[model samples]
Target: MGIKIGIIGAGGMAAYHIAGFRQAGAEVVALCDPNEAVARSAAAAHGVSRVFGDAESMFAALPELNAVSVIVPNKYHAPLTLQALAAGKHVFCEKPPALNALEMAEMKGLAERNKRTLMFNFNNRARPESVAMMDYVKNGEAGRINSAQAKWVRRTGIPGFGGWFTNKVLSGGGALVDLLHMIDLSMYLMGYPEPAWVLARTFDDFITDRTFKGPWGIPDAVNGVNDVETAAHGFVSFKTGQALSFQISWAEMVQREEVSAAFQGTKAGGMLRRLYGADGVDATATDLCEFYTQDHGRSSNRVVTVESDPDMGRVRSARNFVRSIEGTESPLNTPDQALILMKIIDGAYASARSGEPVKL
Candidate 1:
């Protein structure tokens, strides 16, 4: 029995959703995008038999669709998801579930009322490296995690000039939104610790003003009103006294692009990233048992070489979500977990707003 799936939003990410759904063995029945060309192109690409310019039209025309993968802008997530749930479709929405906590709660309530499964495309959690690390920590391979850090730092990069990403209303926040998975991965390795508070600061350089005087490629000085930050710093605390910090920049005065996460515990420590590695306190990999030893009245450091396979890390989350739909398992990226993340992010912004620490 093949599950019928419809896709909303025909953006760059819509393609990924189509691919993941196909990989999960769902039948691509319908496609919806505001742009007709985009919808047609996406339908052709995914072998979806139908296409529409709006989700309401798609839903009304294809009421038999069993599931929907929503990959729309942040502002429309709540209502779109609510309608899908009301129409009796299991929903897999893109991350940052809604614009805020209240919106999240509304959708959550709808899912409960409609008895639908609501999950996020938190592909970060589905990665094999992340799974391998979770197994290691839970098996006492990394000891008790006391501190962790995650970074999806990129050199100078920002999407869309005069676009939604740079506008707070459309994309929520800047680097935090982009680095959400970075933050998610850290807590995931620590067994999904309960976040207690967020202390954060956001920074926005006039990258757009200096580079593209107008909208990206639009070339109009009057259109330079994207007020979102280009970089951010966040310090978070968990219920177990575990601490997490992150540094991420989408566009800034920087030199390179690198992504990684670090876990520190009592016995062993581990780190993951693309470039530029920094070992943490009491953290040691299998081979780096001596890089940071107890040196009385002395200090030293050594480059640690850890082995990892990044490619194989992307299929687990898909399997988890698919199996849950197949009624053989439960969802890993549940609606509740997505709400937890949104709360943390909301707290981060609140902290930045009032220049004070926010208790979770």
Candidate 2:
């Protein structure tokens, strides 16, 4: 039989997870959500036969499940993932693996001790352009990437304003947590350096500005509890003597959104963009990977054109995780890498609050 999978959330991401898993040849047998209506609806839509009001009930109901996709909010990642690991199920967790390094480390330990596969949904890493760029770095073509800059800025895209996303206690932080794809991919392309320090800043200027609320915005009390920053910027120095600068914003006064990662190396500089879909669903345009360097004492620019997966690599991520559980392949993004990311995020937030560089 194929992998028996369960989905632990009924949100937008959960829908995508279910479809991706099915496409990867997994049987999505069960789904769980605190909201009964939501869970039922998702189950019906996905042709899943089992639905539960909570993860505990689902866990008890489906003892034979081989794997689970934890697609809930940031606050519940640790608990849900821990529960899944305890149940001897391979876990596929959403990004920012957990709220902090400590929580992520605990989950990692549990997965390791249980001898189960644990993977992060850093699906963007599977993007053909990302794969190509990473190959360049790994093959010594991009030769010792020493400096990098990544940014994901939106003109007005506050996701679910006045909701858990804006609550620091629930979501950790806005923009930074939601837009971490850029930072994660940047670090991966830079060879996963060991961060030494972080200096950062954040702002909340557009939370109350209703004019800037876009498609993903929601209405709530004007003075709702929005304790997180709408935008953030950080500079990280790695022990390898390399450095990275990153910035992200959910709402900002800008002409258009910017999503790109540029790396400077001793041999050649490379830039990659469109790592994800335009609307984060499907790729509208092909990925762009460009290289710049001096050839024969003359500046030259090369655009490497390669075939890219039309699915934006989402399918690959889901399939690879399942295959890893089947012992067919190894995971590309593991909890240990996510732990490194968490440390950078924690340090960035700490530095933002203390106005001093935080040592990792």
Candidate 3:
């Protein structure tokens, strides 16, 4: 039989997971959420046969499920993943891995002990432009990236003032955690080096300002928590002598929304970026990928081009998870890598809190 899968959330992100698994030839047998009506609606829309009020009931009822896709709030990422893994199911979880390094480490340990495949949705790695850039990095073209800069900033892009996104306990942090794709992409291109220390700071200038709310249309809660930072800037020094600087923000004084990673390597340097005409609107975005090098002492700049991906490889990454389970494709990311990413994020927050650099 083909791979059978279940989804652990009935939120908007679950649609991407469902589409991806179905396209990858996996049978999406069930969807579960605390809101039964919402789960049932999503199931009907996606052609899933079963809907449950909780994961435990879904797992108990669907004994044939061999895998699960987790698309929930950041706080529940680790717990849901651990639950699914303990039930002998391979798991694909949404980004940021977990709220902090400790939780991520525990999830990694459980997945290892259970011997189940645990992959996070580091979707940018699977993008067409990113794939093209990697061809150069892996083939000795962009040799040993020595330094990199990752940015995902917006002038007016706080998701919501009083939503879960602004609740540090629920969403981990603000823009640093929510818009972490660029940081992960930069690290991926740099080979995910071991870090020695991090120096960083966070800003919450516009945290409570509804004027800076994003265009995603997520409503604000009337009386909800909004205690996370609005922006974060950090620098990391890796054990390999490489370094990275990052600027992430949900709201800031900027020209527009920009997502990018630029790197300097021993041989060549390159950049991958997406510029948005409006914050949080994919339709108004423009992507660019290019490399810088010298040929016979003459400056040579090569622009890499590919078909644009509006989903930013979300579906592709999920499909890759299915293929990896089938032994046809290698997973794009591992739990160990996620642990490393989380460590850096945790360190950045710690450094910001203490107003001093944090040592890894």
TM-score of each: 0.84, 0.93, 0.98
Across 176-220, the per-residue lDDT of candidate 2 in tens digits comes to 988898898889888898999999999998876666565763455
Candidate 3 local accuracy as lDDT?
0.92
lDDT of each: 0.73, 0.84, 0.92
Comparing 1 and 3 by TM-score, which wins?
3
Ranking the candidates on lDDT from highest down gives 3, 2, 1
> What are the root-mean-square deviations of the candidates from the true structure over C-alphas?
5.9, 2.6, 1.2
Candidate 3 deviant stretches above 4 angstroms: 279-284
The runs of at least 3 residues in candidate 2 whose Cα sits more than 4 Å from the true structure, single-residue gaps closed, are 217-223, 275-287, 307-311
Please identify which of the two predictions, 1 or 2, would achieve the higher TM-score against the true structure.
2
What ranges in model 1 sit over 4 Å off? Answer: 209-224, 276-319
By TM-score, highest first, what's the ranking? 3, 2, 1
Cα lDDT tens digits, model 1, 99-170, are 887889888888998888888877766655556566667788567888988776555456556666667787
**Model 2 lDDT on a 0 to 1 scale:** 0.84
Best by lDDT: 3
lDDT of residue 260 for candidate 1: 70
